[model samples]
Target: MNRSADIMILDLSESSAYKTNLKHIDFCGSPVINKDHWLYWGSRVLSTSEASTSNVLMRVAEQTEFLDDETFETIAGCSKSENYSQRCSRTSLQSRDKLMYIQKEQLGLESEFPQHLLPDGKFNVDGFILACDVSKETVLHSNHVINIAKSIAKTKKPIVIAFTKCDEMSEECKRHYMTLFLATKELKHVLCNLPPVETSAVKNVNVEYLFGSLAMLCLRSQKLVKKPPLAYHEASLFVEQRNLHVKCCFSTLLSQAVPLCVYPKKFLSWKQVLADIDRHPDLMNFVEVFGSRVAFEMYERYVSEAKELWAMNRLRSHVPRLFEVFQVFLGVVDLADMEWNMARDYMRCHPLFSVLFENNDYDLGMWSPSTFNVDEKSRLPAEILLLPEAGNVFEQFRVGRSDGVVAIVNGK
Candidate 1:
């Protein structure tokens, strides 16, 4: 058989397998041979050639079922009068019912269509990827993650656990990783136990390795039918390069920033600074103002100093109440004047300003008191403040108060 001339487009609607056949028409070869019937659409088929173009169109249309009124109207409008698109549409409707009947009798999809077409006109490939986050204090979170993983496992894809922040672990704490590893192994053993599980972390991590593995699986599946792979190494390489560039930019910033005055050794690093912005992609627009160089430097300084201050002073103890006020200040949380009063009442009960201003004696009057100043609305948090006087050391004494006085009352 000549393969080129043998290419056939089969319309299975008229066949006995019409009910059970879910495969695409292109899967059938030229002069398609089936147990129920044969359809020859190859160039060599004189009968197919002799058939009217309208009849050919109608036969082609018969294979697809239209369920909705709009689709029925669309098929009707696309139909040729001589070929009667309506008749083709009717045949499709009937073929669908017959297919359902066959499924009920054999495959057991008794009352419903298990597979539906995507809006983009493709079949849904039953597959899923499990994204697990395993971190300290997040072990119980694994239960929730596993539930989702199990539901998606039914789709027949590999499940992976993303263990975050493992760099903070000590040699003694290494057993925690072992425990997590065993837990994942046991979970898989009890569950599907189908594909080998993979683990990753954003730090000390091959972030794209797991995704690349999944992509390879999808690619191999596609190759069975001579289709292109869903993902290629080039895409992974692009992500890797993008992340490297971002890290380089962040590192350059940290080096230029001055060490934190209070905690010199605890200065912010490029990784921590970038992690903050990475966690919240929305803040990216503000990064442009610092110019790539200045922005990185200032962000490093700000985050480092902030974290140092918070850690040393135990300021986070005040964060819950402070966050309530800060959220309102940041426009995330809203409250009426009375609510503001309530928040102020709460703040007064806490040593918030005292804790924050402990070592820092910058003039509050010189600085903008309100978190939201109308003039500097567009500026970032660090940019809105004035730098302290360079090398200006003040005496550790408070100035005495003096009052203008008239002569003593009795003397006057």
Candidate 2:
């Protein structure tokens, strides 16, 4: 599959979409995404590539076991005129963290599957769908969501706004919310002439236009990178670099265990301090999941020289699992399947990786202003002594706080 052709539907659960992703996916050619479990009450689904969608979601809505027959009649009547079910049939969907990916070019890409964050800390997809619950308050709250969309657009990625649950709205309510949402600062600037597609997974309202427009937008976005394929060695490196990045967060209280040696250990050496850090209760948690070797790579290493082995490396920032993940993602002449997914699945399955695709930038107390400034009184004090002494007034004066003498990091 052309992984790059996958489009992300950012699952901003906190953005007031009010848990509409599953329903939307159910409506968008993915009712049977996971054969193990049905998302809701969909009996059969209309494939995105199909020509007619009249009875597609209408059938699902009609089969909604919880609904009254009269209600089903009310909903089925609204599905007659989306004018284009083929657009939606041309796509597929999956949700991971704050991201839900849809396949455009890879139209048959698995509807529901796990996704990994490429070692460069980027999702291996193109385009985006920013979904919002169709409510007045959610419409207003979506302004923040649009700012995120703006950033995605600035990166030259295609993005679209999906006002989900319009089936629950009145015509006037839809218009009011659209007017309010479209007038948002970032919305006007980023979307420009593009209008949002109001969708109703229940009624199958405009479902085709939403994803169809996105597929075309994503296709158009790829025109800029339509150059010839990379050379053999370059392709090898691209596959090697597609490894997923892992970050382990800590949530336990280490209030009793000290984290800062800013006061200096009488016997502290640079490597010794790092070794102590490697054994830190919070950090050692990573050793449990990723092992001691991973712990060494995360805490004991200086800079990685291998990072530049591939051209245009995507990971712009460092994460705890960089070295191990480097075993991947080089582009190739032929898109043969690699064993990358096995490793990726293992990495993502870790309990500490709950926020794997969350957009939050975590601080494990690894950075301080001291690294940037030479002066002692900066935000983070430089460790002037190779081994700190408790009696050293200089070290005491330069003390800077970190996670806590005992603290949890990332979500471990």
Candidate 3:
């Protein structure tokens, strides 16, 4: 089965018109699965005593012994116009609030088996269509809505909130719903990311756009894996010898070529790099000039070379678990420090070059403003390094600052 074609509609609103809405929201002849656990009042319930106190909830509470068993089933029963209207009278604001509370309280009590019941083994759910009637009073604030949303939070699937019965709403009511929908982002965590779309199966209002949007979302959701980083050993290296034209950021106060003069000599590995970056008065500033990726590559090369040196000295066992520790740091480190953490993530993208060090891959030439005949005291070139390759238009460039910059130049 085409997993991409599979779309699941979660009737968490427990709308009696669920079947009608599902039938109306066409998936371009693709199979649509209906889950009845929410609609039918069965045996696997929250609390019969609490449910018994409210006649409305009690009827909903008595759905079926097994949630999979559909005594008041929608798929087979919702066949006619009258069937669409034959629903519980709990669509009011107060009733919805109570229902939400019950749903939230009974979260783990019932079986989640219905959720896994896909159309077939070959297919996976592409998106969740949350069907809620706009004619109803309550909306995103209701507990059931939050509960259903939270249930699928871990799935990382895109949620499309379809406001049904739009034809029955006035322009003012539609605006109100839209207002509420947009306001949901402020509800925190759950609905912040979901987009609410107005749809009406009866009038065919946004039915086409509804499914079309889903297809588009499904398409966009399939992210391509990023291409691996260029390996230092594999990359073309240009050592400064003859006069070379290059663009760089320069500060005259330092009176030195930024990349060559600035060095975190005391730090040797990822651990020392991260630990001392914030405190080292000159390291971060130097990193800022050469660009983060180049700095990261530099440190990465340092750690790799250090490891090789240790192994050569017959101290392989003494090498700290930098790779493993760096991986952990990559996953947890804040984005604020992400520029400096590139080495930690290199293993995933460039596994082969993730180890060892090579001297020929880089130029060890010292650059000074005096070479350019600049009389400015402590002048530092912002574009500290440039590696130009033969034939290939793309050349790697680095610029350093707290906010780092790296670029591939396609031409001169």
Measured against the true structure, the TM-scores of the candidates, in listed sequence, are 0.23, 0.28, 0.28
Give the per-residue lDDT digits (tens) of candidate 2, residues 136-234: 433354444445555555556666676666546445545655675566655564355355566655544555556555554555532322232333234
Q: Evaluate model 3: give its lDDT.
A: 0.35
lDDT of 1: 0.31
Segments in model 3 whose C-alpha atoms lie over 4 Å from true places: 1-3, 12-123, 137-141, 170-195, 221-412
- Over 1-412, each residue of candidate 3 has an lDDT whose tens digit, in order, gives 1223334455544433333333322211212122222232221111212222221111112111111133333443222222222222112111111121123223343242223222122224455566666665543345444554555544665556676675564455445545644555433432443345666555345544455444444445312211222221122122111101111211221213222222322323455445644444354444543455765665555445543343232222212222232334333433444433253244335433223322132222322212333232332221111111211111111121123532223221
Instruction: Give lDDT tens digits, candidate 1, residues 95-166.
Output: 111221122222233234443211232112212233322223322433433344444444343333333333
User: How high is the lDDT of residue 374 in model 2?
Assistant: 26
Instruction: Name the weakest run of 10 consecutive residues (lDDT summed) in model 2.
Output: 58-67
Candidate 1 vs candidate 3: the lDDT winner is 3
Off by over 4 Å in 1: 1-127, 138-147, 167-204, 221-412
TM-score of 2: 0.28
Evaluated against the true structure, the overall lDDT of model 2 is 0.36
